[model samples]
Target: MLGIKNWINLNSSSVFFKGTRIATDAYGKDLLVSLYRKYINGYPKFFKMDPLSRLGFVACELLFNSEKVETLQTDNLNEDSCLILFNKSASLANDKIYNETIDNENYFPSPSVFVYTLPNIVTGEIAIKNKIYGETSFYVIDELDATTIFNVVSSSMSDTNNNRCICGWLECSNEDNFNAILLMIDKTSDTLFNIENLRNILNYK
Candidate 1:
């Protein structure tokens, strides 16, 4: 996904685990729980939903703060903006559950489990909420390569008219290990950059 510009990592274990040591270190646990509770509190079984739902909630919360976005507009999906999501773990939790259903012992399919089997769904959810409809896609790479990431983003932004993209890399190996980076870029500017310069800039992080 070559259209994001920020990183918001969350701890699923902290929210999922009830009263455990791992939950204690969640950097933004209370905030997450509070938001979720506020949005879907009345839905008795809302907490039973997937992690993507919670992530969507957080994304919406961040988007609500116009100060954080590069460009803010109304609820129009066909706008000149687009949202793309990239991740290594393509819904491993759903996959694991789906595999259990299809195993020789069970051998049954559950659409609920299959719905989140794609990593792109996370981006889709965000786009749906934000109404970004320029272009969207999901990529599964073995590792995060800055060059590759830059190339993909550069290619997508080649068309100046539709250069605004929200690119994101969200990796969630499990409930405890997850990372998300989002970047928003405008490709109309005639800016110049070199690999060495980028390397030097990124090395500081």
Candidate 2:
């Protein structure tokens, strides 16, 4: 069998993404307060679920956008495209918190809280929303670095089955703070964006 196609570097072409809902507004103001002023009952989605779920929701919203959908479904790569995700915070934080509610000796493990115990569930949710059947994986590490991110992304694309790839770094802590960065990549681009620059672009460094 032929060797897997070399992975395309992220900076070689333009990447598209949608939705980046941070705790602060675009103007660097409090987002929750801003939502309250514009609504009568206040925004419930942000406060109702764990911060990780909220981040996953935003990721789903981005991947499910009309433009992204068109690109994902219509565009064809050389069979070296895949999906890679890097995450720092594990789902255990939320699980740990929710387990406290029932672990007080009276209740058993609550299914509601037990569901978010797996970090990869977030990636699975995004795939379901976008209908993406490509290679999917989630990496949990202590920190996000250029080498680690580049290696995993390269490995995913190194497979002959992948023609293009979408790679990202996602992090969410129980403190209601979360951030995600996504990149869409393919071969055949004249431009080149190095890993270091890509990391800088995503503020990962």
lDDT values for all models: 0.53, 0.54
Question: How many clashing residue pairs appear in each of the predictions shown?
Answer: 13, 9
Instruction: Please provide, for model 2 over 1-205, each residue's C-alpha lDDT reduced to its tens digit, 9 standing for 90 to 100.
Output: 1121112111111112322222323211133234334331333544454556555545445343423435555533312345677778778668777778786686777776677778877666555545567777888888878678877776666677875666767666653455556666665443343566556546632
Off by over 4 Å in 1: 1-49, 56-71, 75-78, 187-205
Per-residue lDDT for 170 in model 1? 57
How does model 2 fare in lDDT?
0.54
3-70: candidate 1 lDDT, tens digit per residue: 23333333443322111122233344344556556433543333443555446445444434423553
The Cα RMSD in angstroms, rounded to one decimal, for candidate 2 relative to the true structure is 7.7
**Model 1: lDDT of residue 57:** 43
Lowest-scoring 10 consecutive residues by lDDT in candidate 2? 4-13
